[model samples]
Target: MYQIIVGIDEDEAHAKLCAEEVVGMPGDGSEKHVTLIHSFTDNPSGASATQLAPVREASDVLDEAGIDYDVTESSGDPAEAIIDAADDVDADLIVIGGRKRSPAGKALFGSVTQTVILNAGRPVMVTGVPEDA
Candidate 1:
């Protein structure tokens, strides 16, 4: 079986974009499985990973594609969480969404996507973050 891990933030459009990419990956849906990971800074409302808006949006796409998927949650650093989740699942590829940013802008604000790409120690697929994100 081929395994994929997708990192989802609060952006529904980006999540859906990544999910669609996974849907188009080479394989019959039966041979693939996706894991959606989300790291929350804080959960004042205490929502499960599956309950998050972006995750649910991604899940919907996976469902329609006849792909199998699971949800994973973390409470701290997003890049670390995504990498750890990928490692835990022994994922074949790690997926994430990112907006185009200048090198200076990324250096100033820091990018979880950049960090994951640099440190994942495996293949990473980046999806274009939508304007709404």
Candidate 2:
């Protein structure tokens, strides 16, 4: 079974993009699974994973593509939560949204994406590419 840990933030567009990538994954078997992780730095309302808009949107994309996923809500550092989920699932790949680069080629990544890219033991795929690229 192929396992993927998708790090989804508050942005629905990013989450959709991440899920679109899932649809393009190499495998077609029902064995392919995705672990959706949404990290909340602070929660005043005490929302669950299923309550988040981004997670729900991502789930919609996954559902349309017939991909299976499990939601995991975490509190604390997003990178840490994603990494831990990856470790827990022994994920084959990690997916996260990334920042687009400036025309001068200066690209800034979100801290969570940067951290995951630098520290994850497994492969990390950052979604969103510069238009020119």
Candidate 3:
């Protein structure tokens, strides 16, 4: 069975899209296990409702697909948390979402997607937010 880790945050639409892509992959749900990860920089309990939205959205998508999965909440840098989770689970693949960003914006605020893509030992699948999304 392939173990997959999906990184999610406040962008619910992008997160759900990532989950959907994984579900659409060639394989029965039983043969692919999914882990949805949400990383928080501070106390998870202090997170506002908005911060948890993506996790909920992604969970709903996986649930509707009848995909076996679990949710993980970690406190630290988002990219590091996601990579650590993958290592803990021995994930075969990582699915993450990205959004269009200006070069200046990317340079100023390093991208978690980019970090994971570079550091993840396993294959990484990246999904992008639709232009209108």
Candidate 4:
């Protein structure tokens, strides 16, 4: 079984898409190990419903797929957290969900997806917002 790290954020739809992609990857019908990671910049008393929504959605997909998985929450830069999680788990692949961004917006705020893609040190699969989404 392969170890995969899936980076999920506030977008539940995108998160589900990422999880679906992970579950659909070619395998020998054996359960794969997955680590679902959610990164936050601020220290909240606890995870708000909105913050937990994506995790729950992704977890549901994994559960239905019979995939072995765990959830991790980290406090720091999103990209750094994802990369760190992958490193900690020795993940074979990393899946990240992202949205369409304008060039100026990306340049102004930087992009976690881009940063992770550039520095993950492993294979990365990026899922984008669906056209109908």
Candidate 5:
């Protein structure tokens, strides 16, 4: 079974969606081990506190579905934290949320998802959220 690591961000809706996708992944008829990972920055003024909530919500769903998973929390740049977590668990897949960034923003500071997609040695999945979310 594939070991999946879903990258969770501060957005609840995006996280929930990613979690759902993880829960729905076909197990090749075998049970897959999933790891829900959320990264937070040291900046309390930021959305760090809410970053891991999605994993908690996702955990409830996994529990109800009888799927097995472990949740992890880390502090640092989101991309780095996610990569590190995946490595820690030897994950076969890394799922993350995708966002649209302004041209200037993308040029000045690369998006985390972009960096992860470019660098993660393992397979990665990117999911988008509803427009209202």
Candidate 6:
């Protein structure tokens, strides 16, 4: 049995699509448990509240899929929190939504996805956001 963990940013549309992909995966749903995770970066200026929208959207997706999952919120660097959660759960796989960025943009602001890909012990599945979403 595999424990699948999906990282959701709280974007309802993006999260809905991600949950659909998870549920629609070619496997027995009974053999897997999906866990949804959300991380908030510690912004001294209090930027964490901005994450509610995406997290809510992600939760809606799980609800619609009828996949019982756990949603957690944490305050810290996003990469660290996500990695910690994956480790705590001993997840077999991780799914995350990413926004594509140019090389310059990536260099200027390193992506959490990239960091997780490098450091996470489990497989990571990254989904890209559609232009319209």
The best candidate in terms of lDDT: 1
Candidates in descending lDDT order: 1, 4, 2, 3, 5, 6
- After best superposition, candidate 4 residue 37: deviation in angstroms? 0.4
TM-score of 6: 0.82
Q: Of 4 and 5, which scores higher on lDDT? A: 4
lDDT of 2 at 106: 34
How well is each residue in 1-133 modelled by candidate 3, as lDDT tens digits?
9999999877878888999998899988788899888887767368743358788888888889888998887777999989999999999999999989998898899999989999988899999884567
lDDT of 6 by residue, 8-124 (tens): 664666676677778877776566677777776544655443256766666666667666776776776777777888898898888887886898998899988888899998898
- Local error of candidate 3 at 63, Å? 1.1
RMSD of 2: 3.3
Score residue 128 of candidate 1 by CA lDDT: 80
Candidate 2: residue 121 Cα off by (Å): 0.9
Sort by TM-score, top down from the best: 1, 4, 3, 2, 5, 6
RMSD of each: 1.3, 3.3, 2.3, 2.0, 3.0, 3.0
What C-alpha lDDT does candidate 1 achieve relative to the native structure? 0.93
Residues 1-133, model 1: lDDT tens digits: 9999999999899999999999999989989999999999999999998998889999999999899998989999999999999999899999999888999999999999999999999999998867665
Instruction: Please report how far candidate 5 places residue 70 from its true position, in Å.
Output: 1.0
Q: After superposing candidate 4 on the true structure, give the runs of residues whose Cα lies further than 4 Å from its correct spot.
A: 48-51
TM-score, one value per model: 0.95, 0.87, 0.90, 0.92, 0.82, 0.82
Name the weakest run of 10 consecutive residues (lDDT summed) in model 4: 42-51
**Runs in model 2 with CA error above 4 Å?**
101-110, 129-133
4 against 6, candidate with superior TM-score: 4
**TM-score: model 3 vs. ground truth:** 0.90
- State the lDDT at 6 in candidate 3: 94
Give me the runs in candidate 6 sitting further than 4 Å from their true place. Answer: 42-51
Candidate 6 clashes between residue pairs 3 or more apart in a chain or in different chains: 10-54, 10-55, 11-54, 12-57
